[model samples]
Target: MREEYEIYEQSLPWILEAGEIIKKRIQEHTEIKRKSSHSDVVTEVDREIESFLVSKISEHFPEHNIVGEENVGNRVSSSPYLWIIDPIDGTSNFINRKKDFAISVAFCERDRGIFGIIYDVMAGKLYRAHTGSGAFLNDVELNAAGTDGSLENELMAINAPWGSMEEMKRWEHFFKLGTQVRGVRNYGATTMELSDLATGVLGGYVQYYVNSWDYAAGRVILEELGYKFSDLNGDAIDRVYCGGILAASESLHQQIVQSLKESSKEIK
Candidate 1:
């Protein structure tokens, strides 16, 4: 476990270096390619950054398994020590020259994550956390204030795509929650949304679809801050293929889940 913590410490600099590279090239002209849909796209910079990160990890930890967004076509072994990388999350935002994108990384052992890092390249802020340790923004530790947990008084980050049928068929309950909350925001980047949640600025976050790399980093950081995490059905998110996720204070989490359940029963 101590060795794992040491490795976690070593990854911080590598991630920061990647963030610098991202900021330097963010404004340069780049080519974009469509992925599953037109809205889901990838830029050349994304591929380059992913390759660089993978290379760095390979050089230092050759035996560890990696699941990177750009190289998902290749199979990753179910090794106990694994790294999940989203070289440039919110690629569309990055392509549009928006400052809402981020670089997200997570290190895991079997089912337990050791640490997570989300670097907001444009904001020059690094959000990170290790198991049992508190979450942090840059060097300052983050503490959940234990206030503003109510939906009517708290802000939430609910990505716009979640309301679309392609991402979720019966997501109307989520839309209803939006109206109940004090304010709702669509940040286009899960890492930023979850990072804000860790800082207690955003009370909650909900998304209908996300991969392991998408939420893995946020999961570790938010958990360290005592944030509640679970699926829409209020199940534990211990598996890699979590169907969906809801993160908030424990009370707010239950409220959202209970609301969804009632809404579903009405539909039935």
Candidate 2:
């Protein structure tokens, strides 16, 4: 516990400093470029903030390995300590909405996460959590997830195959979950979506595929509050990456999982 706090305190400043850089850079003209596809994008600010944070980890925790979305620095295949980072979790949001983006970081010792931090830069809302400690948004502690363990009338966030989600008849699993909930919302940003789950504002969240940096921090924060995270098939997930994710309360997660498993390829 003491060690977790120590690491958390040390991490706060480094991440906040990176947030400041993003706030400043967001106001200026940004250079945007495409990645795997036209919809997959990265910005100059993303690279800059990631490089800045990588340097901090290198200086403060020299032996730690870093795996950032931007691929900023010296990366390794494995290390005792690893820092997963998404300097700008919502790069497209930063470019479009400007206020919906966040900076996400998670520190892990081997396979266990020590702490996680997600800073909603424009809103000045910093969500953080350490193992055994409670989750927080800014200074206020957040409530546990699945308070009622019921999904009735609760908002759901779905992130899956873009095309599958767009075309109603595509992926029956995603489409079915949408009907089971009161309503559905997608921020196109995993950190924000996960924070909503951590805060209990969102009843549940699911994604067909995501990188390690996308949900590593959120997984730490949510798990502390009794929330559950697993691959769509309800299997344990590793920190590296996975096919998909289903996050919610234990019971609710299983219910959703069952729904996904039973749904046919195309809705009849």
Where does candidate 1 clash, by residue pair?
Answer: none
Can you tell me which runs of candidate 2 are displaced by over 4 Å? 164-170, 265-268
Q: Show pairs that collide, candidate 2.
A: none
Clashes of 2: 0
Candidate 2 per-residue lDDT, tens place, 1-268, comes to 6865787899899888888898788889999999999889999999999989988888877777888998988588545888899999988889998888899999888888789999989989999999887889988998876545665677889875756435745565787778888889899899999998887778899888889899999999999889888998888888776578888988888888888887853454
Stretches of candidate 1 off by over 4 Å are 72-75, 145-148, 160-169
Residues 121-169 of candidate 1 have per-residue lDDT tens digits of 8898999999887789999999863733567888888653534665454
Tell me model 1's lDDT, rounded to 2 decimals: 0.82
Q: Give per-model TM-scores.
A: 0.93, 0.93
* lDDT score, candidate 1, position 102: 91
